[model samples]
Target: MDIKNLSLNPNYNILVTGGAGFIGSNLCEAILKNGNSVRCLDNYATGKPENIAPLLENPSFEFIEGDIRNAEDCLKACKGMDYVLHQAALGSVPRSINDPFTSNEVNVSGFLNMLIAARDAGVKRFVYAASSSTYGDSKNMPKVEDIIGKPLSPYAITKYVNELYADVFAKTYGMETIGLRYFNVFGRKQDPNGAYAAVIPKFVMHLMKHESPTINGDGSFSRDFTYIDNVIEMNVRSITGKNPDAVNTVYNVAYGERTSLNELVELLKEYLGEYDSKISNVEIVYGPERKGDVPHSLASIDKAKSLLGYSPSYDIKRGLKQAVDWYWKNLQ
Candidate 1:
């Protein structure tokens, strides 16, 4: 998972939109580790300043406080960049359900702004973060790239539109683009507080306080829980990989396995119990099934492997252990 060994251009100047967020900040950190320059653009709407505070003094790191929804800001951020890692978006199914207009504005319209800016700036490649929610109602156990069902939520629709836009930009503008459909990515620096917080980090924070962590369904719902390091490696490969066929296409970024919600809670308890013995006594609550939720989601990463040479370095257990240790050290 060490991206410093990747074949990145030494003189590369990469622009990472939403670079104050979890995955975006990690991309900035990884690129800087490879001795490349990175320009970070974020408005701190969902991204925290503390995430990138330590990187402020690095000579290779540059931060721009801007919003992607503004076309002018997008143009300014895209300036002087060899590559663009576009990760700026408003993410959450329930949040989109409540406010579809804003979701469409940021995820869809804002995405278009970034693409136009990247194309106009003559950026080499555009690597973006797509989501597994695009699979929608597809009952396929392992989701492949070519097959997808109709989108179920505003968030899913926005992501699907992003893929469509990327494809159109590639064909019409001759822009090189890669879309990674991430499957439940989790790890360090992921926000555990928020009304729309992800299940893993929210559950960890709750369990730390010896509180009951709620499961949205009957605990049978499963996900292809990918680790952050694995995600970072795939992104780096998408940019540095020399294969021509890999460009202008989408790939699933996952560990190629699924874990049920019930099993996930148990594993978290086991890991956290070692740090505080009382954590094992915390309970789990089962709530009603949520809207726009699929019963199961597992990704077939064969396309990524065959094309980009993707090899996941961490399974769920190993990743959870690392995350638990990090939370215990930093967030406790």
Candidate 2:
């Protein structure tokens, strides 16, 4: 079966939880671009309709204003869908630290609700957004899927629980599930305004406004910083790749290269400076490290490549350039 056709079939309707969010919107667009039908379910708590505004005109796309925290919403969203991309969650360490209970309700309980609903709906595959934070405190340079460490934050605990629950569902319910453990994803449509905004977008936004961006702890902390396109490719592969050996496994979705904050800032300045010279001199302010923050994260994509034919198309520099260009044109 053609992968694109599989995603679009009326019989294979896809439900993308949090489909209005940055990553989810990108995934939705990709699915639609491939002639697939997609129903986006989002509560708009952290997602913006503007992110998906362009797709509203597409006949293949449907939007449902809903929350994953509600079992009824999940059940309603899962009805007759062939695949479920569970991307909805309360992300960010600080956010979860400040509101652990809300995070648990949305991330843990919400995830379980989706899993059960998808199983009951008899969806062909249940693919959820797992996280690189699951590798917390492992001290491993390139984290592998089989090895993990203690979760550092409530958010981490919730994501780690997704994998655990998925494993259980596969054994108990005989469901086919895959978890994509994303590493520091950044790209177009990423929200840059929130206090909990991710590093790349936040820095890009600050530089665009000619403001200094804060660098938590030292600038030496590094990340894998996988681009959105790479993530989309992984999602499509995970959903359609028919290899029985690759089913029901977790794979790291990343570029497999580490870029430090210092280098990242320099690169961003270089890229954004081409559009405005004033941004080049924007200095970074160092501050106390935030709680539950990891010093470095790099993923081993060997498993994804060998098993799923996964190949990342963008490195940090190229990805940041694309992201910065988008922010400059759209945000400004």
Best of the candidates, TM-score: 1
Compared to the true structure, candidate 1 yields what TM-score? Answer: 0.99
How would you encode candidate 1's per-residue C-alpha lDDT over 1-332 as one tens digit per residue?
45766677768999999999988888888788888899999999889899899889999999999999999999999988999999999999999999999999999999999999999999999999999999998877799998999999999999999999999999999999999999999999899999998899999999999999999989999999999999999989999878999999999999999999999999999999999999999989999999988889999999999999888999999999999999899888
Displacement of residue 131 (Cα, Å) in model 2 is 0.5
Give candidate 1 regions above 4 Å deviation.
Answer: none
Model 2 spans with C-alpha error above 4 angstroms: 1-11
Residues 1-332, model 2: lDDT tens digits: 12353343434578899999999999988887777789999999999989899999998899999888889999999998889988998899999999999999999999999999999999999999999999989987789999999999999999999999999999999999999999999999999888899999999888889999999998999999999999998888888778898979899999999999999999999999999999999889999999999999999999999888887889998898898888888988
How far off is residue 254 in model 2, in Å? 0.4
